[model samples]
Structures are given as C-alpha cells and as structure tokens.
Target chain A: MVRVAAHNIISPLGCTSQENFDKVVAGQSGIALRKKGELSDTDFQAALLNMEVLKDKISGIANAEAYTKLEQLCILSLNEVLDGVDVKSERTGFIFSTTKGNITEITNNPHAVDALLATTANKIANYFGFKSSPQVISNACISGLAAFVIGRRYIDAGKYDNVIILGADILSKFIVSGFQSFQSLSPEPCKPFDANRDGLTLGEGVASVVLSKADNTNKACVEVVSGAISNDANHISGPSRTGEGLYRAITRTVGANEEVDCICAHGTATPYNDDMESHAISRAGYETIPVSGLKGYFGHTLGAAGVIESIISILAMQNNVVIGTKGTVEQGVVAPVNVTKENIQKPVNGLLKLMSGFGGCNAAVYFKKHGE
Target chain B: MVAMLLFILKSMENNQIIKEVSIEHGKVLINQSEFFTGETSDLGPFLKSLYKQLNLKYNKYFKMDHLSKLGFLASEVLLLNEGIANETDEVAIILANASSSLHTDVKYQESIADIPSPSVFVYTLPNIVIGEISIRNKFYGEHMFFVQPSYNKEELLDYTTCLFNSTPCKYAIVGWVEVNRNGDYSAKLMLCQNKK
Candidate 1:
C-alpha cells in the first residue's frame, strides 16, 4: 500500500504541520483586511503570509533571487521533508501542482512567464538533484489533490517507488484583481457555510507531501485508499444546482459503505459552492458525517488548498479530533449536514477530502489511518 | 515465470487506441487524414467555420480563448462518432501541454492593469479548456491537465493504461493541447479504449 512518508506546510498559519494544526485548533484566523493601494486597488481581506518571514528564511539560501516567491515557498516547504532521502534515485519522482506559477512575473516579462510552470518545476527538481524530469498538474484549484492522486498512481503503477509532491500558489495583483473582477472575493474574512456567507478570501501558501510504496516505521503515515475526479458538465464558472458531479465523485471514492468518519470540504464561502457541497454530501448519504470548513482558517489557497487541507485532515484523523469550521455561525444549506462548528473529540478512522474548482471539476479522495 | 511474463505483455497489448486527431496552425487531421486547413491569418474564422461545420449549437465557443477553442475543435472531431458525447460518464479526459495557456495569460495580464476582465480572467488557467470541452459534451468523467516540455506519448500511454486498469474509466480521451506565446497552437487528441 502507498503511504504518506512525510508532509510539510508553509502558510500564514505556520511553517510546520504541527504549528499550523495547533493554531487551527485554537480557532485563530489568519485572514485580515488590507486597504486599497496595498495588495490591490480595492480593499480586500485575505490570508497573506509574512513576506519578511519568507524573505528572512530565503536570505540564508544561496542564489535566492533565482527563485520567485511561489518557488521559494515550495522549496522551503519541501526542504523539511526532503532530508534523509536520496532525491537522485530514479525510483523517485517529483510532481508540482499550482494554478498559477510565477504569474506575478508576467508584468515584468511576459515571454519568461510563458514557460513559468515548466521552468519552475525543472528548477526545483534540479535543486533537489532529482534524476527524473518533474511532472506538473495545473488543473485549477483541485491541482494539489489531483497531484496526490497522480503521485499515488505512479507508485501503484511501478513507475516510481516514491514521489515528492509540492503544491503552491501566491497572491498577486493579477490574481486578486481577477477574483475581484469576478466579484468572488469577500470584503471581510470569509464565513464558509454560514447563512451570511458572501465569498471566498484569497490566501497564499505552499505544502509538500511524500508518497512512498514502503510503509514508514519512523513517522506517522496515512494510507492512500482510493481517489476519483468528475466534472459537473453543467457550467464552466458556476456549480451545478444538482451537485451531480460531486455526488458521483464522493460515492465513487468512499462507495456505499460510507466508512468516512469526517470530511474536509472545499467550502469556499461562496453562495453556490457551499450549497452545492451540502447537496452533494446529502445525495451521497453522508449528511450526518462531521464536516469542517478550513477556509476560515486559511482562506482559499487555490492549488495548495487541496494538499494543505488534505494534510490537515490526515492529521485530524491521526489525533482523533474533528477540526471545527472557523467562521460559520448558522447553517445555510437546505440539506442536513453535521457541520462541525466546534472541534469534535471522537475516534476518527477514515477521512474524506473533497475539493471543486472553476472547471466544473470535482475531486474526492479517501484516506485511512495506517493499518486500518 | 516465462509464461506469466508473456501473458502480462499480451494483456497490455490489448489496450489499443480507436482513433487519434491532430490540430495545428491552420490544419486539422484525424487518423492522418486532412479534415480542414486554411491560412494562419484566418485561424479564428477557420475555427468558427469548423464549429459551424460540426453543427454545434454551443454559444460559449465564441468566447473561449484560442487554446480552448482548439481543444474544443479537436475533441469535437475526435468524439463526433464515438457515441459517448453527453451520455456516458466514464470517458476520462487527460490532456497535457508545453505552454500552459500563456497566450491568454498575457492577454489577461494586460487587462489586469486597466481593470481585470472576468471574461479574460476565466480563461487564464490551462484546464479551462477541459472545462469548456466538458461543458459542451456534458462529460462528468475524470479529467486532468498536465504540463510537459514536449508531448510524451509514453507517459500518456502509461497513465491511460493505468486508469483503464485500476479505475472505473472505460474510454480515455488523452493527448496534448498547447498554445505558445506567438499565438501558434497545437492539439494532438486521441480516443483510447480496451479491446474487451
């Protein structure tokens, strides 16, 4: 069975999974409001990382200028997990996931940004001395979870024994303004699944996870059970009112057994997204399952959302505590769901991670505690 | 051991593709047959003419960027006869490219300076093309968009075979769709299925 060998998270919440998890469990939010003429022309609330902290960490590294902010976040996040492993082995592969890589570089030189994703992957692989060429998944917000699925498949297919997966995305004027143009950015901190919820708060972060064929005896590990992806085929930008795609994906991943103890949902705080997820969960007969919306803690980190959230969910499973939804005060969806507004102390076994994105893409992956 | 090895290899050979199509500047080819061609300057009109030729009624086609338009056109030509359009939910779509929507990205960046246009911003991501195709065809199957330095057919074959083996996917629409900064575009699409 494929297992999670190691995982690291670098976000506004913290630099390590333990630190981030502690902050999350404490119910502290990283999102805050910034006035116009700062990050954007209009006032917006988002969970932005401390640039001084990131810059200070990068200052000690050689040739730090060669890497962009997103790339630096990726390297810093992966560095913790890459140690004690031989990255130059052919049996090891590197996979990078992002919605936009070095997108901020576009204003400076559009030509260079043309190859930003591929070039960034190569740069990180070369830095780590990986023998194999890297793989990139840029499938909107589901990219991180998609990367995990692809990484596990590679190991199962015997193409590699271990895969290093890194997912990252940074905030920029281009991305923020684009979301503003879509009118999907919340003016204040996001309130996911709440009746008063308006929109999502954009966030920036990076995370890395190592998937290995061999079981890890020295560290905590989560088993990769099954994963599936489906599209709504309803609207390009809007989610299906029926939640058909997400229902199919959740059912396909967990099956009829419904062994899922808790779920980490893609609650973007948008009016349609939360409602769509509620319907999808109920249709899959998982309405009573404990669900947590982590967006209130980290906002929506785009490509990193899936990986970091998955990591958080796996940690919750290990600790046997359901993380609470940070910003919801009242239930919004018509369907019934046990939305966890406060941390639930119980024996957690199987965890479900779900995320959906603009392409009408919905992805669900099931994870179990090791030996379960 | 020898017998088992041969059996495994034999089973792998059964995963044969049914059809493949290629779309490049001013040209569209299916199974090595030239289906359409025109001057580069008229690429937009050419795609429009092709869309009209298909008798498709999807009005969203006009608003799509060049990359999505090319992917939509290629998928239309590939699945026109597959009988899986909007009916089957098991046909997976796996597409890869070298340049991940850089043409539209540049255009979108230009709009961000003035006022980010939602129309242009939505097309900034590479996977938007897959969404366009999925919406048009009503495909709710599995999909992924990858970025590679070049079209690696071996990786495509490996992953497609793996999906057919391990997942519920029966037929996979896989290939490369790319649009460089120069506005030049190429999409090599194929429809693969097991012989069972």
Candidate 2:
C-alpha cells in the first residue's frame, strides 16, 4: 500500500496542514472581497495568499526571485514535506500537477518558455536534484488527485520507493477573466451545498504530499487504498445531470461491504456540481455518509483542491472528527446526502475524496487509516 | 508465483497496437497510410478542408481550438470503422503534449485585451480535447492529460497498462497531440486493447 509519509499545504488559511485544519475547525475562511486591479477591473471575492509573507518564507531558497510566485509556493511546500528524504535517489519519483503553471508569465508575452507546464515542472524538479524527469499531470481540476494515483502506481510497479506529488495554481487576470466570461465566480464567499449557493469563489494554493513504500510500523498513517477516474461523456463545460461518471468512479473505488467514515466532495457551490455530486453519492449508496466540502473555506483552489482537500480530510480522520461543511446552511441538493453543517466527533477511519473538473472528468480516491 | 504469472499475462496483452493515426505538417496518416493531405500550412483552413474531405457531420469541429481540432480529427480517423463506440464506456483517452493549449491560450489572452470571450476561454485548458472527443464518441471510461517536453511513449504505455490492469478499461486512445502558437501541430494517436 502507498502510505502518506508527510504533507504540506500553503493556502490562504495557513501555511501548514495543521494550521489550515485548525482554522477550518474554528469556522474561519480565507475568502474576502479584493480590489486588486491587476487580477480584475472590478472587485472580486477570492482566497488569495499573502505574497509578501510567502516571499519572506521562501526567501532563503537559492535564486528564489528567479521563480514565479506559483513556483516559489511549490518550492516552499515541497521543502516542508521533504524532511531529509533522499530526493536525488534513482528510486524516488517526482510528479507535478497543475492546471496552468506559470500561466501569468504569458499575460504580456504568450511565447514565454517558462509558461510551458513542462518547463515549470522541470525547473521545480531540478531544484532538488531529482535523478529522473518529473511526470507532469495537467488534467484540469482533477490533476492533483491524478498525480497521487500515478505516484501510487509507480510505487506499486516497484519502479520507485517514494514519490513526491506537488500541485499548485495561482490566481491571475488570465484565470479570473476566463472564469468571469463563464460567469462562474461567486460575488461572495462560496456557500457549498447550500440552498442559496450561486457560484464558486476562485482561490490560490500549493500542496505537496510524499507517498512512500517504506513501512512505518511505529505510527498510524493514511494509506491510499484505491483510486479511479472517469469521464461524464456529457459536456465539456457542464456537469452530467445523471452523474454517471462520478457514480462509476465511486463504485469502482469502494467495495460494497466497505464502510466509509466521511466523504470530501468537490463542492464548487455552482448549482449543478453540488446537485450532481449529491446524485452520484446517492446513486453509489453513500447518501447516509457524512459529506463536507472544503471549498467553503479554501474557495476552490483549482488544481490544488484535490491534494489540499485530501490532506484536510485525512487530517480530520486522524483527529477522529468530521469537519462540517462551513457555508452549507440548508442542504439543498436533488438527492438526499448527509451534508454535515457542524463538526461531528466520530471515529473517522475511511475517507472517499471526490473531485470533478471542466473536461467532463471526475475522480474518486479511497483512503483508510493504516492498521484500522 | 501468482504475481509472476499475472505479470507475464499483462506483458502478453501489451503487444497489440490495434490502430494508429498521425497528423503532422498538413498530412493525416491512418495506420501508416496517407488518409488525407492538405496543400496549405495554415491549420484552420487545412483542418476545415480535411473535415469536408472526411465528410464529417459534426459541426462542433468548427468551434474547437487548433489543439482540440487536431486531437479530435486524429481520434475520428483512428476509430472511423473500428466500431469501438459500441463499447464506448470502457474506452480510455490518455493524451500528452508539449504545448498545453498555448495556441488557444495566446488567442484567449489577446481577447482579454478586448473582452474575454467565454468561447475562447473554455478551450485554454489542454484536456478540453479529451472532453471534445469524449462528448462526440460518448467514451466515458478513464481519461487523463499529461504535459511532457516531448512524446514519451513509455509513459503513456506504462499508464495505459496500469489502467487496463486496475480499472474496467478495455481499450484506450493514447498519444501526443500538440499545437503551438505558430500554427505548428502534431498528433499521433493509437487505439490499443487488451487482447485477453
């Protein structure tokens, strides 16, 4: 089994996984209205990281100024999770996940070589003297979770003893304007799975997780049991009304007799996504499982959503508490799902992390506490 | 002993390359034979002419970005008479490219100078090509997009092998589809299935 050895999350809520989790348990959010003319002409609500603080945190890294903001954040998070791991070992693998890497570099010059996802990924991989070329996953929003799946496969194939997955995406005029054109951004903090939910609030974050094959017999850890990805085959930009792909993914990951403690849903707060997730959950016979969405706190951090939310949910499991869906006031989905409105103290062990993206792509991952 | 036997079975299943299609420099090749060739180097008109030549009824082809058009046409030509659409739900799509929609991303960025067009904005992501193919063919199986410096056959093959062994993936459309801002494009897709 692929075990998560260490992880780090750099979101607006906090810098580390524990910090972000503490803030979520206390019912705090990083989203706020901003008048950043660089990102948008008008005011917008999003969970934006403090660039100044980030620069200070990553200042000690060599030639940090040469890297883009997203790359800096990635370096920071990866550094935190490395923890003396032998990154240069031939058996260690690196995977970079991002929907758009250094996309802001193309705002003025579209021909910038650094704007290429592969180039940025290579730069990050080269920083720590990785022996092999990094595998890059740019599969839209599901990229992060897909990276984990690939990492696990590498370890399972005996090709690598450890794999580091780093996922990050930053907010820019390019991204904000595109979502604005789609009219997908919410004017206020997103209220996921709520009756009054209108749209998603875009956010920026960087997350890193280290998956190792080494057995840690002394401590409890989270094991990635299984993962499955499927396509809706419905529409490129719209959620499937039947949630066929999500249902298939969920069923493929979890067995009929397996008991799930909680579900971390990709609740973008867009009317169709939350409703479709509810349908998929109920269709998979998981309607009674307590479900919560971290978008209400993290504001839908695009590529980082999968890894960031997975880390938070796993932390919740370790704490033996199911964190509430922060902004969900009245659960208003088509299918009846046990949407948690407040933190519930429970014996959390198994977790089902779900995410769906713009490319009609949906992914589900099942994680169980080791030795549970 | 069981693991060794399973490994041998998987290796045996990986030998079959059912079909292959490649689009490069205004030429379309199906299974190493020239299917269509265009005289012009411009991508938009070349793709349009090829679409008409293929007698395709899908109108959405006109709306796709250059990257998506290349991938969509390659998959269309690759699976033309294959009848794999009957088992559409198990067909996986694993595509990689050097340029991740930078051709359209440049166009979308230019539109931001005026007004961001949602139509242009939606195609900025590289995986939109997979979405287009999935929509047209209704292949709801496993799908993923990778961005590599160049076409790495081993990576695609390794991942496809994993899917076939782990998931319900019976067939996969895998290859490299890339389009740059200068109208340069290349797409090489292979239809593969586990013979077992």
Candidate 3:
C-alpha cells in the first residue's frame, strides 16, 4: 500500500497556516467577492489570497510565461512542503492535477494555449528533475484527487518510489466567468453543508502533497490505504442522485469492516453539488463522520480542491482535530448530509476525501493513521 | 529475446501513417484515402461525421459523448480503416495531441460568458478525447498524448515505451488530432504492438 503523510500548509505569505487553521476550525471564512459574465450577484467574493506577499519567500527559480498564477502557487507550495527533500530520484513520478491546466494562458492566446495546455503536467516534472515518467489527469473538479488515486496505482505497481501530486488553479476571468455562466457562484461566502447556502465562490490557489514509502516521522501525516475512481455514467454536469460512482469508490477503498472518522465533502455549495456530495457521503455509511467542506473558507479552488483539501485533512488529522464546515451556521438549505459545526476535536482512525467532476468521473481517497 | 526485440525494432522503422486528412473549406482531403464519422447526437454531429470517415468499424468501442465523441469518432476511423488496426498487430494510442472536446469547451464557456449555464460549463476539459476512445474500444491499454513542436521518431518511440511500461495495455493508440481554426482538422492514429 502507498503511505500518505501529514501535509504542510504554505499559502501566500500573508495567508498564514495558523490563520488558515483558525478560520477552518472555527468555521469562519476568507472568501472575497467576485462578479463577471452573466452572474447578476456582485456582492459575493472568493478566498482571494494574495501571492504578491510571498515574493520575498520565493526567488531564483526559472519561470515561464506559460506558468500562470496557478503554476506560481505550485512552485511556492511545493518548495514549502518539501523544504529539505530532494526530488532528483528517477523513481519519483509526478501527477499534476487541475481542471483548467494553464487555461489562463489560453485566454491570452487560444491557439498557443490549446497546444501548451497539455504539457503543463510534464513541465513540472522537467522543472523538478523527476526521473519517472509523469502523467496528467484532468477530470474537471476531481482531477487532482484522480491524480492521487493514480499515484496509488503507480505505487501498487511498484513503478515509482514516490509520487508528487500537485493541484493548482488561479481565479482568472476564464474560470470565474465559466462558473458564473453556470449560476453556481455564491454572491456571499459559500455555506456548504448549511441549510441556507446559496452558491459557491470560485477562488485561486494551489496545494502539493508528496506521497512516498516514507513514515509519519518523515513528514508532518496519514497513510493512504485505499483509493478508487468511478464514473456515474449518469449526468454530465449533475451528480448521480444515487451517488453510484462515489458509492463504489468508498466501498472499494474503506471496505466493509472499517469505519471512516471524518469526511471532506466536495461541498461546492452549489445546489446540485452539495446535494450530490451529501448523498454520496451518506451512501458511504458516513452519516456521522463530522463531515465538513473547505469551499466556504478557500472558495471553490477547482483543481486545487483535491490537493488543497487533502492537505487540510492531513493537517487536521495530524493535530488530532476535525474542522467544521465554515459558514453553515444557519440550516436554511435542504441537506441530506451531516455538518460538523461545533469545534469538534477528536482522535480519528481514517479520513475519507471525495470529489466529483465533469466527464461523469468521481474519485474517493482513504487516508489512515500513519504507522498503522 | 534481444534478437527478436531488435528484429521488431527494425520492422517499426518502416512504420508510417497511410492517410492524413485536412478539412479545408469544410471539404475533407484524405491526402491518401477517404474516411470520417457518420452519426451524431448529444455529441457533435458535424465533427462526428469527420471521425466516421476516418474510423473503420470494430466490434469493441465506446459510445460518443458531446465533447470527445467527434474526435474519438475520427481517430477511430483513422485507426481502423486506414491507420493501424488493420495493418499492425500491436497498436498504440499516441495522439500527437489535439483537443479532447473543443466544441464542448466553446459551448460550455459561452454559457458562462453570455448566459448563466452550469450545464454547459460541465465539459470544458482535454482528456475527453482519449477517455472516449478507451471506452469505445475497451482500450484499457498503453495510451498517452504528447504536445511537441512537431513529431519526432525518437520522441515517439521513447514516449510509446514509457507509456507501455507505465501500465498494462498491450496495444497503444497513438497520434495527433488538431482541429484548426479554419474549421479544418487532421488526425492520425497508429498501432504499435509487438509482432514477435
């Protein structure tokens, strides 16, 4: 089995880890406002963290124009998480995940972006000197999680010593407008798992986690015992009412005997997404796992959600705590899922993270207590 | 075993695509042979027709989706009738790299840009091309796409081997699918399975 370790938190310099932790655990949020395209609401914002604050922290790495804001976050976050570690081993493989892989570049030049977009994953491998062959996966919102699951397969196949799974995304006009078109963006902070939630706020951010054969003492973490990805084969944009793909993934990874402690729901806060995620979690028999979502605090970081939330889950697990769903104080919306609102601190055995995306693809990843 | 590998390698030196069609002015120039897609539905009918012209029929294949159905359809035709399925024993899905779903991407984005439409925003992605094909032919084999300045033999063989070794799909479905701005398109797929 591939072991996953606790995660390191390194957002923009101004976006402190402790602050991120506090906001998450206290159920507060940092989502800023945004509006473009057909979206009528102008009052809502996203989790707009400033990268300019970290300029002093990251210097000397050669960058490309092709490397948009998301790529910039990737380099910074990767450096923070792997401070002393060297990624020179040929046995190390990279699986870069993102919904819009450098699509911002495309907004500038469609012809070039169309050609360069596919190479963004490999660019990281080349940049970091990773020896193992790299792979790219873009399953819409679940892309990053899918990358993590694929990394598990690679480790299972004994094809790599470690997997560098990075999820990055930036709030460009392209992404913001796209979400706005769907009428999915919340005018206010997202109220995931909350009854009165209106919509979600799309944000900009990136998160990186290094999965290796190493132990917990090696990193800040959890162990990835099982993971699975399946397609609903139902609706393209809408999630399966029965949570078909999600159910299969959870059952396959957690198995019949084990029980999950806390769950990281997709929690896009959209009507359909929240409902779908809640249904899937309950279907996985996680009715009372102190379920929560990060969208309220970080906004919907799209591709970054998988890696970012995985990092959040790892950190919470490492600290023997469970973060509550932010901005879900008033139960006004209809939700079949359980929401952990109060500050719940408990020692958990395993953490299950689930994501659903376009192409009807969905993935569920299970991380257990390290050294198990 | 080494000698056999060498013999196979020597034979691959003669590998090449039989047909390369460029859709200029909405008319297809097979350059070598005539081919493309015939049907359409939730997917793109206009583009699927191109794929029907390129793909030759096979017993195993996945149904087309709005995004990749067209590209898969064309690549399927190129693969079956003129490209590699009939000519070689081993095949590889090495797409010189093209949009998995450009039409869908454009449509989806428009919903967000002009109208509030999440249904349309659902399909803006790239891998829809290869995924559609994998399902169509049950081609859970060695497959990958390379974005390069142009095709290079060294790059192709090296990439193919890396792809083959990464997973367990014996036959590889590989080539390039570029939908030009002029509404013209050209794609080529080849099978690179071991004969020995």
Candidate 4:
C-alpha cells in the first residue's frame, strides 16, 4: 500500500505540520482583515503568511532571491519533509500541484514565461536536483488531493518507489481580483457550514508529503487505501445543487464496508459549496462521521488546501483527535452532518478527504492508519 | 495487482483507438486526413471558421478562451467522428499541456487593468476546459488536467491505465491541448474505450 512517510505544512499558522496542528488545535486563527492597495483597493479578509518571517526562512537557502515567493514556500515545505529521504534516487518522482504559480508575474508582463505553472514546477524540481521530470497537476482547487491520487497510483504501478508531492499557491492581485469580480469573497472571516456563512476567504500556503511503497507494518503510519475523481458535469464555476459528483467520488473511494472515522471536507465556506458537501456526505451515508473544514484557519488555501488539510487530518489521526471546523458556529445546510465544532478526543483510524473545484471536478482520498 | 492485470488485459482486448483528432497550424486532421485548413497567423478567425464548417450550434464555444476552444473543438470533432450519443456518463477526460491557460490568462491579465471581467476571469484555470467539455458532453465521470513542459504520452497513458483499473471509467478522451499568447497552439485528442 502507498503510505505517507513524512509531511510538512507552511502557512500563516506555522511552518511544520506539528506547529500548524498545535496552533489549530488551540483555536488560533491566521485570518485577518487587511487593505493592501496592490492586491485590492478595498479591505479583504484572508490568511496571509508573514512575509518577513518567510523571507527569514528563505534566506537560509542559496540564491534565495532568484526563486519566487511561491517557489520559496514550496522549497521550505519540501525541505522540512525530506529529512534523510533519498530524493536523488531514480525510483523517486516529484509531483507539483497548484492552481496558479507566479500568477502575479503576468501583471508585469502577460507573456512572461515564469507565469506558466509548468515553468514554476520545473524550476523547483530542478532546484531539488530530482533525476526525473516533475509532473504537474493543475485541476483547480482539487490539484493537491489529485496529486496524491496520481502519486499513489504511480507507486502502485511500480513506476516509482517514492514520490514527493508539493502543493502551493501564493495570493496575488490576479487571484484576489478575480474572486472579487465573482463577488465570492466574504467581507469577514469565512464561517463554513454556518447558517450565517456568507462567502469564502482567500489564503496562500504551501504543503508537502512524501509517499513511499516501503512497508512500515510495525510503525504508526497512514496508508492511502484508495482514491477516486469525478466530474459534476454541472457547472464550471458553481457547484452542483444535487452534489452528484462528490457523492459518487466518495462512494467510489470508500467502496463497501470500509469505515471512515472522519472527513476533511473542501469547505470553502461558500453557501453553495458547504451545502453541496452536506448533501454529498449525507447521500454517501457519512453524515454521522465527524466532519470538519479547515478553511477557517487557512482561509481556503486553494491548491494547498488538499495536501495541507490531508496532512492535518493525518496528524489528527495520530493524535486521536478531531479538529473542529474553525469558523463554523451553528450547523446549517440542506442535509445533516456531524460537523465538529470543538476538538473531540477519539480514535480516528480512517479519514476521507474531499475536494471539489471549478472544473466540476471532485476528488476523494481514503487513508487508514497502518495496521488499524 | 489483480486490478492492474485486469487493466492490462482490458487494454489488450478492447482499448482500440476509436477516433483521433488533431488541430494545429491552422489545420484540422481526423485520423491524419485533412478536414479543414485555414490561416495560421491568427487562431481566432480560424477557430470560428472551423466551427462554422463543422456546423456546430453550440453558442458557448464563442465564450471560451483560446485554450478551452482548442480543446473543445478537438473533443467535439472526436466525439462527432465516433458517431455515438455518449452511451455512458463514465467517459473520462485526461488532458495535458505545457502552456496551460496562459493564452487566456494573458487576456484576463489585460482585462484586470480595467475591470476584472468575471466572464474572462472564470476561464483562467486550465481545467476549465475539462469542465466545458463535461458540460457540453454531459459526461459525469473522472477527469484530470496535467501540466508538463511538453506532452508526455507515456505518463498520461499510465495514469489512464490506473483509472481504468481502479474506477468505473469505461472510456477516456486523452491527449495534449496547448495554447499560448503567440498564437502557437495544438490539440491532439483520441477517444478510447474498454470494449466488453
């Protein structure tokens, strides 16, 4: 089985997975209201990384100024997870996931090659001196989880013994302005699944996880049992009212008789998204499972949401706790779900991560504690 | 392992190339036969003329950015050549490209100078083409969009094999679709199905 060997998260909350988990478990939020004329004329609510701190972290690397902020964040997260890992081996592969990489570069020159997602991925992969060509997944918001699915399959197919997956996207005027055009940005911090939930808040982050085929039967680890991707065929920008795609993806990933102890949902806190997730969870018979959305803390990290949230879920499983939905106050949706509002101390052996994106794409990854 | 074997066997049994379509250099090819040829300088007029020649009535085609239009046209021709009415919703779309949506991203970036056009802003994502195709074909199955420096058929085929083995996907439209601001573009799509 494909298993997680190590993971890291670099966000506003902290640099390492454990650090972010501790802050999140303490109910500390990284989100704040800010007015940056370069990003938007009006004040916006988002979870932004402290640039000075990030600069200090990036300063340790050689020729750090040459790399973009997004690339620097990716390097930082990947470095934390690559301790003693053989990334130079021919059997090791790299996969980068992002919605937009260096998108702000386009503001300077629309034709800038650095603005291309593939270019950014290649630059980072080459920086790590990886032997093989890096693969990139850019399927909107689901890119992070989809990368895991692809990595697991590659290992299962004997194409690689290990795969390093990195998902990163930095906030920019290009991104914020686009959301502002759609008016999807909430004036306040997002309240996912809450009756008063208005809209989603944008955030930036980078996350990394190493998947390996080496068995760790005696040790505590998380195994990727299965994963599936499905399209809603409903709308490009809006989620399906019926939640058809997400429901099918969940059922396909979990299959029959596999227990899922908790769910890490793609709760962007948008009314349509949260409602759609509730319906999908209920339809898949997982309504009673302890479910929570991490966007409140991370402010919808887009491409980083899946990997960062998945790593946090794995941490929760390891610690035997269910992290609460940060900004949610009262349960509100068309269907019923056991949304965890406060940290619950319990054994979480199985976790299912769900993400839906702009392409009518929905992905689910089921992970189980090794030897559970 | 058994699923992988099943996938291999299935490929050997019925994964025939049903239809192939390629659009590049102001020309369209079906199974390597020229279907349409136009001016290569600008893709806008060429795409519009091709749409007219194909007698497609989908108005949404005009709204898509160049990348999606390229992919959409390729898919439309591929499915049209297959001569089937989308028998199943399990048709998967596995697409890869180098430029992603940079062609349209550039345009959207230009629009940001004025007012961010919500219509144009929505198509900035690479996977929006997949969504457009899904909406057009009513396909409610698995789909993924990959970005590489160039087309890597072997990797895409491997991922498609895994999908066929692990999920309920019965067919797939896989290939490369790329577009850039310089009007350099290409779309080569093939339809494959696991025949019973």
Every candidate's DockQ is: 0.60, 0.61, 0.17, 0.59
TM-score of each: 0.95, 0.96, 0.74, 0.95
Model 4 regions lying over 4 Å from their true place: B1-16, B39-41, B83-89
What are the per-model C-alpha RMSD values against the true structure?
Answer: 2.6, 2.4, 7.4, 2.6
Model 1: number of backbone collisions: 0
Candidate 2 structure quality by residue, lDDT tens digits, B76-192: 899999877543568889999998989888888888978899998889899999999998888878889999999998778877887776677789999999998787889999998
Where does model 3 exceed 4 Å of error? A5-19, A34-43, A58-67, A83-86, A113-115, A215-221, A330-336, B1-67, B71-120, B127-196
Tens-digit lDDT track for model 2 on A1-372?
788989999999899999999999999999999996999988999999997777678888899878888888899999899987899787788989898788888877878999999999988998888886898898889999888777887777666779999989999899999999999888888989999999999999999999998566456888888888888988888999989889988987897777798999999999999999999999988889999899989998888889999999889989899989988999999998999999999988899999999889999998888654
Model 3 lDDT vs. the true structure? 0.60
Candidate 3 lDDT over A105-135, as tens digits, reads: 4443545543354466556666767665555
The DockQ-based CAPRI class assigned to model 2 is medium
Query: How well does candidate 2 match the true structure in TM-score terms?
Result: 0.96
Native RMSD of candidate 4 (Å) = 2.6
Candidate 2 residue runs with Cα over 4 Å from true position:
A214-219, B1-15
User: Which is superior by TM-score, 3 or 4?
Assistant: 4
Better of 2 and 4 by DockQ: 2
Location of the lowest summed lDDT over 10 successive residues in candidate 3 chain A = A5-14
**Where is model 1 more than 4 Å wrong at Cα?**
A113-115, A215-220, B1-14, B39-42
- lDDT tens digits, residues A1-372, model 1? 788889999989999998999999999888998778746987889899997877778886568888777777777888889877679887788989999888777787888853468888988888778997899999999999988888887777677788998999988888898899999998779988999999999998899999888755445567888888889988878888989889888887886664889989999999999999999999888889999999999999999999999999888888889999999999887678889999999978889999999889999999988643
What TM-score describes the B chain of model 2?
0.91
Tens digits of lDDT, candidate 1, B1-196: 4532443464476467889998776788889998877554355777777787778887788889989998998999999777874745778899999889788989988877687899888888899898888888778888999988889876777677767777777788899998888877778998998654
On a 0 to 1 DockQ scale, where is model 2? 0.61
For model 4, residues B1-196, the per-residue Cα lDDT tens digits are 4554554454455455677899988899999999889855368888888888789999788888888888998888888846555524579999999888887788888888789988888898999999999888888888899998888876777677767666677889999999877878989998877564
Q: How far off is each candidate at the interface, as Cα RMSD in Å?
A: 2.9, 2.4, 6.4, 2.8
